[model samples]
Each structure stands twice: as structure tokens, then as C-alpha cells.
Target: MYKKLLLLLLFFKCFAGFAETIRTDVLVVGGGASGVAAAIQSARSKIKTILIEPGPWLGGSMTSGGMCILEGNRTLASGIYAEFKNHIRELYKPRLGYDTTTNAPLVFEPYTGAAILKRITDTVKNLTVKMNTPFTAVKKDGTGWEITIMQSGKAVTIKAKLVVDATELGDVAAAAGVLLTAGFDSRTDTKEELAPQNATNQIQDISYLAILKDYGRGIDRTIPQPAGYDATQYACLNNADIKKMLASAKLPNDKYLINWSDCANQYPITSDDLNPENREATFKKAKLRTLGLIYYLQTRLGFKNLGLTDDFKTTDHLPYLPLIRENRRAAGMVRMVLDDIYTPYTRGSQLYRTSIAVGDALPGQHYSIPGAPHINYPPFPAYSIPLGAVVVKEQENLLVTEKAMSVTHLVNSSISYPSVQMTLGQGVGATAAYCIFFETTTKNLKPRIIQGEILDFKGMLMPFADIKTTDRDYRAIQQIGATGLLQGIQKPNGNSARVLFMPDSVVHTAEIKPFLNEIYSRAFLWFNKEKPGELFTIGNLLSYISEMTLRDPKNLQDGIQKTWKTYYKFTTGFDATRPVTRREFAVLANRFFNPFARKVDMSGKFIN
Candidate 1:
């Protein structure tokens, strides 16, 4: 106890006086897509929010990294992400010929994206954006946190109720002494079959994403040959198929988001990218690599008109931040594995219930060794990012978002899209605000509460691409699908088969009984075996439910009526002989198994 007192005294002594001290309800470390979204949502919640960004601008990859191409399913994006996309459309509709109705042109100039983010934040009350500020240190100060930031060579201290590790590399988590997994986690560590036998710090290549604009014909805007320019490095340009892929990188605005695809713009870096001692040197090397690639494209690849765009002023048209694909991921409550997307989880688990965000990026291996068999992961169902995966273990008020969340390397490949990051950022920020309002830690907070709030915010917790919001049973279908109890039937064809959720078809007792048995340890009478093609009636469901709940089927009339009332609000006129629709089964199954089913409006907007 006395030693602890000494340590506390030392902590106070270290931050006894700083150049400036600021206090806020939340402190966001990075101004990336996730960080910006978090700050926006937190401030929108009427809390004192402060965002500290190392660069002069906001929008990390979307702007600073020149990743103007919007990847992932934009329809699943909600809240701040949706607003940002709409703002982009409004800003570029007349000038760039964007369709105001739909997101026709998913790409934009980097500066335009940054300016839009700045414009939105300027209007948000109680939000402070500290540009050109880098986070240096973080320590727990009583119930809150004290973060030391370096701004303009002056040390600034910020005390906040919560700290969000929105840094692209999980910097805040590192400073706060949180357990982080770097590079490829071992198969034993993540239980992913694709994971390396031994954890290696050799991460996926970081891209200094360059924005090159086409100047039509007869325009010579080619860059001068860069120093150490090697013509042989880009020999893949000779391959007709590879050249076609590179040519297809052109955006609608005639600007190309050149990051990868055999052009050799991506540079493989080790964990040294985050090393404080040699990080700057590593970044410089990466920059030179990209600059060389640009020169090669102009001089050797016969693209003389294509030159760097003037969108990024801070870095002289170069991206401010290198797009680091994989980094130090925080070891949160749930570490997402390959099976989370490829295989279904156990029914009724928290992972199945507490979805905060969703992503469905097709997993591609563009950075690995050439001729290495690329495992093209088939377009998967839009899977959820569980809330438990964002809450950092052993930390009271810290949340991990963006590419730094607790996910295996294999899983991160599919989930690290910029839109998904923004969606998750909003959820994390909202969760922080809720925590402050209720005066509770993230661990003690209930998953149902978080999930409900996210849904209310127009943020999607489930990503069913086939199911529209206006569908008659969107919410019920979503809730049941989330429990891992329902899965789409896969086509029996070859490797090109697509998974389909046949929503309108009548479900059979034999088809769905196994799922029910797995979720609820129920016993069924073996007197009669139901036929494979027989439609599962409402009466058949009620009898099975009765046996599952350990109640006699003969005496379950009142109980069945009560169950129907609880879920469907049906008072009388029940038709037990009627065939059960997929929608009806969804509502009944969700209401019975989901603990927070009471919070959902079973027959509201979901049932259009």
C-alpha cells in the first residue's frame, strides 16, 4: 500500500505542470476514419469531445492516405458514415457530375473528402479538433485518463473520462500498457487455419497510396525519373493480363487510387513501422518506394499523362499517412477468428447477439509473394463485428476501433474497409457516451443495451445484403440470423456457388428442428418422424416448443397463447394448422431465445 502511494506520487509528479492542460469527456487519439467518426458521434451526444490528429487534416486513409475509392458495401454504412457519404455527394454533385440520388461515383479527390470532414466537425458543438498533434504518452488517472500529447513542440496534457484507441496502429493501447498482438497471430493464438505456425512480425505491406490524375492526350505531366529508379521492378507490366488490371485502376474522375496490383507501390515493412526510434526512417523509405513507382509508371509503363494530383497539399500531393493494412491489434474480450465469417458461432452466444458493425470485403492477397496461390475468399455474408471485440480487456474506459480492433490477421483482411471503420467508430463513440451517462465501465455494460442503442441510431448491427430495410420482416430476419441459428442455403454447384437466404419458402420441421435442438436442449417425441417435404405448421412449432420448455403438450394451450402474445401480440384466432412462414419462424425464435427481445419492436419498421 505504501509502495502504491509512492507510485501515485510519482505519477502526479510527472504531469505536475505541462505547457497546457485540457479536459474532455472523451479523447480520440487519431483523426483517421474511425477517429473522426468517434469524435463526431461523441460530440453529437452532447459530450465534451476532443480529437488529436498528427496530420494537418482529418480523414486518415479516405483523405490523407489518398484511398479515395470507397470499398465495401456502402449500403451497410450508417450514421456518420452515411452522412459523410451524402456530404461528399452534395459537395461533388454539380462539379464532379455525381448523381445526387445514388452513390454512383464512389471515389473522390482526397482534399475534397478532408474538407468535407472539416466542415462537418466545425458545426458539431462541444467538439475540439487538435490538428498536427501527436499522442506521446497515456496513463490511468484515478477513474479517468491523462494523455500527454505533443503539439507544435509543446507538451499538452489532456484528461478525459474515456480514451479511444482509434490510431491506425493502436498507439493509445500501447501507451496505456494494453496487451496487443502484432503481425500474423499463430494458429494456436487465434485458432485460424490460415494463420502462421509461428507469429511473425512481418506484416502485410503498407501502401503509400498515390493519387494520379489523367491529363487526357498531348499533356506531358510525367514526373522526373526518381533516384534509385529500377525499371526491372515493374516487369509485371509486360504481362497483358496484369497490365489490364492496372489500367482498370482509373476512377470516374480520371484519377487513379494507385496502391497495389503488381505495380509494386506497396512496401513490406516490419513492426519497425511503429518503433519510435526508427519509424520516421521507415516512412521515408516507403515514400521513396512509392515515388519510384510513380516515376516508373510515367517513364516505363507508357503513362506519361498521368501525374500526381494536387489534392494533398500537406505532403505535396503525396499521401500524408501510409495505409498500414495490419498492425498491433488489442486483445479484447473476443478475438475474431477466420471461423467468425467462414463458420457460424454457437447459438445464443454473446458474439451472436452483440453486433456493433459489419464488413464484407472480399479477402484478397495482393501483397504476398508472387505465384503464391491467392486464396480468393468467396464473397461472404455480411458478418457482424461484435461489441465484445471492441472493448479492450483489463482497460476500464478504452475502446479499440478500425483496423486495430481485436481480430486475427485472416479476419482483419476482410473487415478493415474504411466504411466499416467509420461505422465501428460511431458505435464506439456512442458506447463511450452511454458509459459516461450511466457512470459505468464498458465491462459492466450490457450487450443488449449497446445493440439497441446502435440500432436506434440507424447504425446496422446485422448486414444482410439480400434483406432490404423496407422488407416486411427485416428486423426479425436480422435478429434471428444474428443468433447463428439461421443460415443461407449454399448452391450445390462448383466453387462459383452463391449463398441464398430463401426468405419466402416454407421451412420444413426436419430442416429447422436440428437448429432448435442445438440452441435449446429440448427433447422431442419419437412416435412419428416428420417427412422431409412436409411444411412445418404453427401447431408443430408449438408442440416442439412445449417439449423444449419441459411443459406437457396437452396443457400448453395457455402457455402457447402467452408466447404468441409476447412476440406477435396475438390475442386469439390462432390457426395452428397454418404453415409457418420464414418471417413468422424468425419472430418466434428470436423472441424466445434472445434475452433482450423485449427491447425490439417485433412488428414495427421491420414489418413494413
Candidate 2:
């Protein structure tokens, strides 16, 4: 009996060794655009990283889905996404004669974009790219995670400290049992201007995109008729609404993106496409619908010569995957709503301190249910993406990227764009690295620390053209603006009144009184009696800072005097009537944050 028990122990130990094991500091699942960025950033930080992509290629919708044409302006694209665009320009500059000086090389072929991603990721020393591998299961192994992935019909186990769900559909989040929501949210649920009264399990229709080759003139290139092809099913193709949508969907290189409003293959009715039960059948139906759309374009619209391009060779002429607009969004620590984008953050709010990523894409219209209210998002300025939106609400050691992020359906439409997704990915990667470096959880890591890391990578937490890098108090001013303490008050500038943060502009008592009241809750009632156009004084600035920070006015004054005596040689008596310039206010503000500083610089004294 003793011999038999020893043999049993040996057998179990041997089995454990036989199983494949891979270890890394960060394991990013789903090699989509965000996943690729996350893996690159994490590995570049010197962490052992493993990136698993189910598809053979990288660049999710940005590449395989044939979304090569970049969206948003050059100001919006920064960090890794900007680097990727620059690399693409380098690859095609000789071939296409695109000007390297300008940021106009936003368009590229599908294969070229994918190849660029592959080549760039291959150069990272600590990153391991596992192609054609899908995440099967994940469980908490102590404070970390042990993930099971299926690669070539064999299961491989990977142990990692951090896991990011960069899947286009939030697969890893679901597998980890993270709190998630799907479909449309009600007005009561999110208080959004356009959300319906009652929530519904309906999402924006996904498109099976096809890149068409423009073979100028006429030539017979009609594809075989798709199964169950019907003529009456697409009577709305000629409608005015569809014609406008088609015009917007047109791409360069004589190619037309076929997914348009009220026409072709946009599946409006919500079905089991996201449900695991009927996923396969739903995918087939979607593919057939696209094929039918092509037939309509050729036979009905009289474009017989236009043939489908063989860009995605793996999936015939169509893209390797469908362009999914919405999915199960993980409930994060901070859920981003329309207000966060359309309006500015309130002063002294936590949201202001945590702004990490920035995006400028306008929200796209949602057409999940027929006859649903077609809500439109008004044009807004570029906004910051808070770190709370990426950290999972309840789950530990996990972060979500792409459409799975914590945002309302309306905000999702804007952030779902590949460029924005990459920004969020880079932020997440940096946050993950910080968490690993500091030996802290995502919940415990502060946003300011993460923001510092993002800035180090040349990321734009706030990408305003007016905010230059050379500003003396750039970081402090950015922090203030981020908190919505002082928004750009619109002033007339000839033809248009553009809102701008004129940092050099002096602040008057009238402008600062209302903000002080908002922050201090009417603590200093005497400020209401100040004269109009009176310049904010040094004494007023000190009192306001002391009150805002809940410090005793006399104590703060004494500390400031003592610090000034230690730092400066020619300090006389305190002057209360001296007008405080913007630069002086910045110095006082900086000192307020770091009261223990032994030395103070006065370079900003010349600033208005």
C-alpha cells in the first residue's frame, strides 16, 4: 500500500510537468489594435509579455476588418497610434510619394497595415506573439491569473501578474466573470440625452465589410449569386437617406465601403450573434447578407465591372472578421457618460485628477432597433479618458480595452474607433506596468502616477493646440484644467469666438469669486463684496488656497513666510496689495501642493 501511494504521487507530479507552461508578467488576450498596443507598451517597460491573437493577423478592425483609413485629426492621434501611422508612412513613402512632413498618410492597404503591425511587434524583446490562439479559461492564482489558451488543438497554460481583455468583444472579461452590460441603456440608467426611456437588448448593427476594386470602365466581374438572394429585400437602397450614407462611406483608391444606412447588409434586428448558442449560424447569415449586397451593387446598381478585392485572402474577398460596433461593456470604477464628453468635469472632482487617455471621435448614430429614436451627439472638443473607465469594478488583476470599456452606448460609438481604442490601450499598458512595478492592485494605483507614465510616453492627456509644452506651469495648469476648475471662457476673436485657455491672461476677482464659492462652499463670505475688475492679489490667492485645502489661514501664512525666508535672500515684509499674475498664482499653487519644498523657482513671475 505504501509503494502504491508513492507511485500515485510520482504519477501526478509527472503529469504536471508534461503540460505546456508559459510565464509572463503581462498576458494580453486578443491581438486586436488595443491588444497590440497594450502588449508593446507593457513589454517596452521591460515586463515579460505574451500577446495571444485568435486571428492570424494583428490590427483588428484597423487592418483585418479593412478599416485602414485612420479617423480623427493628427492632434487626436498620439503615442503608439501616432508611431504606427509614422511607420506606415515610412513603409509607403517611397511607393506612394506621400509627403513625410504632413500627417496625411492615414490611408493604407489592409495587408500593408497588418504587415506593419506584425513587423513592429516582432521587434519587442520581451513580447511573445501567439497567433491563432484563443483564450479558453482564466482563474485567480493567488493575486495573479492562470490562463488557459487553445493553440493548434493543444491547450497551453500561462501564468501572469496582469491580464488585459483587449478582445473586440470583451471575451476575457466575460470569462473572468467581470460585471458587464450589453445593448442599449435607458435614459434613467445613464441620464443620457438620447437614451430611450426603457433599456433594450439591442446594439448597433455590425457590418461585414468588403473592399471593392475599381476596374475603370466596363468588364464582367460579377460574383456568383448568393444563396436566398432577393431583389425586394433591398428596395430602400435607392432612398435619399441611403444615398447620403453611401457618400459618407466612400473611400479613396476608387473603393467604396458598402455598409451604408437603410441599405445593403447592415443587420438592424438584434439576434443571437453575440450569444454563444447561435454564434456560428449568425456569422454565416451575416456573410451571406454581404454577398447579397455585392450582388445588388453589381446587378441592380449596374456596377458589373467592380469586383471584390482580394485583400483578406484568408476569408475570401470579405474581411477576416465583422466590424462589431458594440459588445458587453465591463462595469468599471468610473463609467463614462455623455456628460463627461459634452460637458467639462466639475472642480475638485475625482474625475479631473484621473484623466489619462484622450480621443476626439464624434459619437456615431445607433440603429439597433427599427424606428428607435435616432439620437445625435453634438460636436464637442477633445476630451480626456479617465483611468476609472478601464479598471474593472469588482474583478481584480484585470483591465478592459476596446469596446468593452466602461462607457455609455453613445460614448461607446465615439471611443470604439480604432485610433481611440489604441489610445486607451496605451494608457492601460502603462497603468499595468506601474501596477506591476509598485506591487499594487489596479484599484490602489493613483491616477496621477499613471498620468505621469502616459506623459513620459509623449501621450496627450489633453491635446489642445493652445496648450504648448514650453509653458512653465504646464503640468499644474493641465491638472487644473482637467479638473474643470477653470474652463476656457469663450472670447470673441474676429469671425469666431474660439474657447481657449489663455494661460497668460490675468484673473480678476469677479472670475475667481464664483469658482472659490463652488470649491469652498461659501467659506469666505466677504469675497462677495470685492470690487469689479479688481486684480486677484497675493493675499487673496493665499487665503483661497489655504481655504480650499482646509488649512488654517494663519498657519499657512506662517509656513509660506518661513519657506520664503529659507529660499530667498531679500525677503522683506508680506505684501497683500501686490497684484498676483498668472505665473505668480501658478507658483503659489505649486507651493500649495508641495508645502515641504525648501526652494522655490520664480521663472513664471513674468507670465501674465
Candidate 3:
């Protein structure tokens, strides 16, 4: 360990001159779902961009990290998130001629996800994605950022006008001196009803997910046993209810993800933790811990029949990715607080002003469990991610991405999914384009301007509806509400006569499928393209948009019409011939917009 530390120190000392400094319109760190979208958006905008990922492969959750299962509303997705799934569907399905039962074009594989990221980056000139590059530090240089990165034992530098920290953990922002809070800060501090009464520093333990393929009939395939398997020490999640039912041979849903299945703290560290100060040691520690997890599952539990597969395991069970849970968040113009989540009271949210993308999902797990290893799905309030959430408080040029953006612990629990993370990435990308076009700095932009830009961006809309009109923040609220970007709920007095907009009420993607499709149908008409009368696969449209947006960043408008047109033209192959797909106006849910984008309704269809 001493030798490794000394070697690292020496390497840093000698690598000064080797640090290459370049300039770009945007700098995206971390190549996960959000980072990929951020890079794609910036590159598509024709803006110079540099993307750095610590791992050799892309797709932090899907590839190196082994998070293949996409959570949240798959169909509610409109931008990069939609495109990724669509590509997986089209690329994998066009060859197979049939989709897997999940209705996803095909089940995703890690490498395929990685290659798709590479393909998008390679196709865009403005985007330059580098593998095995870990960010070391970030400095605010008055104009933008001076970011230092390490690769191949050398330091490289980038002077970026905008920086997106899509790292699974908020490494850059924390290093850059953003005011960061970890774990549960407390209800008094966070103003969250759900905040634990007692404050704690223990962030939820990151999950090391394993992909198990069941061949049906209780027959386990010859997948290999994971490395360092021991026969006497493994333990599964041990859910009492599941254990009782296990006698009947059934496993509950949560346990399948291996919640508390093993004690993973014993694994060794194999890489840097992406922290400049001690990432190498931290990462090496992570490796041993991960190995311990796999060991417990195989030999310790006597799952002799269970084996590992390199095809999925990728260089042992040590996920090439880190399951990060927290990061530094900029104190943006408007912090979406826990108070905003109550369905009974909150409304006229200033969030309506700066929302670029939006979503609603429940925060899943808490760190400390009351019993037996863990607890099942716990419910929290639904919420939206506004544009201000990703912009740093003082930085005039940068936008955050993925797990790096601002979110109180309450909402962070919900927005951390790879799909949602990708949505935020796309929103940041479009915003970067807007920032470039307007020659404006991110910090200088307001909610209205940001809203306008997003409405005109290239991705599809998450459903939103404005429950109120003629209010001071009407323009902002209506921008989302008119197009059904947010949802309208009962009035505070429980009277339906006067509707109140409960912007804080959490709405899941699953609840808004009808609204999503309605918006898509309108999108078809607005783009003057053919809308296949049949159930159109969301992926086809997503791919076309991604394919184009990856090249043209400003189709960046999210006004329902522009978004619809972009997707419609991309999907129907507009030969200037196809009966119009819509004849009437459509209204989407004010229920919930994917918490990441601010969309526009252009067909004069959704303006409330």
C-alpha cells in the first residue's frame, strides 16, 4: 500500500508537463446515462465537448456497473433516455425479429450498452469521449472551469465553459467546493417529513447488482461460480416473508436485486475511487469489498450450482462501476425542498420556471432497516427536477449531470435511476446548446429563459398540466401545465370546484402512460409526419431523435410542437406523404413530467 501511494504521488509530481489543456463548449465527467446524454447534446449542438469516464467502457450503470434493469417510466422518456432504450430495442430486435417479454426491444447486455455510448460519441464531432480517464479536481476559473483529469498515469487538463458532473457520485462538485450535505441531514435541516428524526452520516449502502439469468423450471445454467467463492459464509437477503415462502420456492421482488444478500465490505480495492486525494486506495478497497460480496453469494451460501459468467461478470464480479449514492449539489436559484412534495398543500411552484425535464418516482430504500437485513419498497412523495437543480449557484458556465446535480436527499432517492439520470443528461445537453446560442452563462439564465429553451429542445415531453391560470408565475407554470408537464390535483379544501396544482405531489412514470402517448400523437402531427396507426414503439422515435439531436443540438426546443415534429419526422421518414396523424388537440397530465425537462406545446394543442 505504501509503495502504491508513493508511486501515485511520484506520478502526479512528474506528470505536470504532460497535462494537456484543451477548450470546449462543455465538459462532461462520468460516462454513465446522464453523462452520455450530456455529451451527446453538447456535441450535437456543434459545441466542442470532452467526456471523461474512469472506466474503459461507457454506460456506468449498464456496462461496467452491471445495472441492466431500467427503472421508471420507460415510455414517459423523451430524450437520450428514450433513445438508449430505443436503440437497444431496434438494434437488438431488428436482428431477432421479436422483442423479449419486457416489451423492451431486447434484454440489454453490458458491452452492447457500452458500444452504443461509443457509437453516439464517435458520431458527434463536438463530443470527444475518453475512457479510463478519471477526474481529479475542478476549479472555478471566473469564466468556467479548469478541470484536471488523470489517465495512463498522467494528468490532462481541460478549460471548459460548462462542466457536467455525471459521475455516479458527485465527485467533481464536491471537490469544487459546492455546499454538500450527505445522508439524511435531518427533518429540521432538510425540512423533509420523511427525514429520519435522528441525523446520520451513513448513506445507503451502494448495491452491487448481479444479473442472474433464469432458464425456467428451477434449472440453473452453468454460469461460473464467482471468483473467491467460499462454501461456508454466504447469506442471501433473508427476508422473513420470503424465507417463509421460500419453503414454497418463491423469492420476493426486492431480494432478486440482492438487497442485503451479503456483507460486501470485505472486498479489496482494485482501482481509484475517482477521488483525487485517495481514489486509488478507495477504489482498491472497493474491489476487495465487491469480491467479498460475490464470495458470500456463491461458496458461503453453498450455491454450488450458481456460477459466474464473464459475458456479464466482466473481469470478476467487481462491477467496473461504482454504485454511488450521494454528491455535492449547487444551491441553485430555487431548491426543490421536501415541503414541495406534499400532495395536500404545495402549488404554484417556482420550479415551473426553470424545469427542463421532469419525472416522478418513489425514493426506494433507506439505510438502516428495522429488521432482517432490510425492508421492502417504502413510499416517499413524488417530485420534479427543475433546471435550477443542475446549475451551480456561482458558476456562470457549467451544468451538472446525472448523480452530480442538486437534489435534496429526499428526491435524490427517486431521480438516481439510470433512465431518469439519462433524461437529466439530455436536458443539460440542450441547455448547453441554449447557453451557447444565447452567448449566455448558465448562472445568468432565468427559469423563463431556461423553460423557453427546453420547450424548444429536441427531446419528447414528460407530461405536465398547469392547474392554475392568471397567477404571477403563470408563464412558467403554464409553460409546463398547458402542455401537461405537471399535474393538477384537488383544491386544498377538498373541493373540485376550484382546482389547485399540487406540483409537489409525486407522480410515477407508470401513472402517466396515457398522457405520454397523447403527447406523442400530438408530436406526430406537429412534425407533419406519419404516425403509424399501430402502437408505435417509443424506441424508434427516440433513436431518430438521438441520431439527429446528437448532430443538431438545438432542435433543442421542447415546445410540444417542436418536440413532436422532431420525433415525428425522425420516426415516419417523412416522404412528404402520409395522412396527418392527428385531427384534434391533446392534453397531457399536469400529473407529472419526467423531472428533468421543460417542454413546449407548439401545435396550440396544450397551451392552457
Model number with the top TM-score: 1
How well does candidate 1 score on lDDT at residue 110?
82
Alpha carbon lDDT at 311, candidate 3 = 42
By lDDT: ranked, best first:
2, 1, 3
TM-score of each: 0.81, 0.80, 0.65
User: Which segments of candidate 3 are over 4 A away from where they belong?
Assistant: 1-19, 94-107, 151-153, 212-293, 300-302, 312-317, 342-345, 366-383, 452-461, 464-608
lDDT of 1 by residue, 1-608 (tens): 99999999988876666437888889888999889988998888888899999998898877888878776655465668878887877667676545454424366788888999999999999899999999888989876899999877988789998889888878888888888777667778777666667777666677788888879888888776776778877776665453455455655577777876555777766676666677788778778778887787777667788888877774447888888777778888777776766554443233645677767555545564443333445545557777777888888899888767888877787667787788888878888877887888776756556666666666666666556555655666766665545665544333323334566666776666665544444333421443323788777766655555556776675666666656565434457787766666676666544523433211110111
Cα lDDT tens digits for candidate 3, 1-608: 99999999999867755547777778888888888888887777678888888887888876677665564534345556666777776765654334434323224666677888788678788678888888877888877788988867977788887778777767777777776555555668766666666655444445555543333444443435444554333344332343343223211221122323234332222113244577555655555545555455444443434433444445654466556544444565455665454441234443533456655444545443233122222333333466677877755676666555666666666677677777777777877777776777875554445455444443432232232122233334445443343454422322111233544343333333344555454443423453333333233233224333343423322333354545333233332123221110111212122222433221112222
Question: Which candidate has the top score in lDDT?
Answer: 2
lDDT of 3 at 520: 51
TM match of model 2 to true structure: 0.80
Stronger candidate by TM-score (1 vs 3): 1
Candidate 1 displacement at residue 435 in angstroms: 1.7
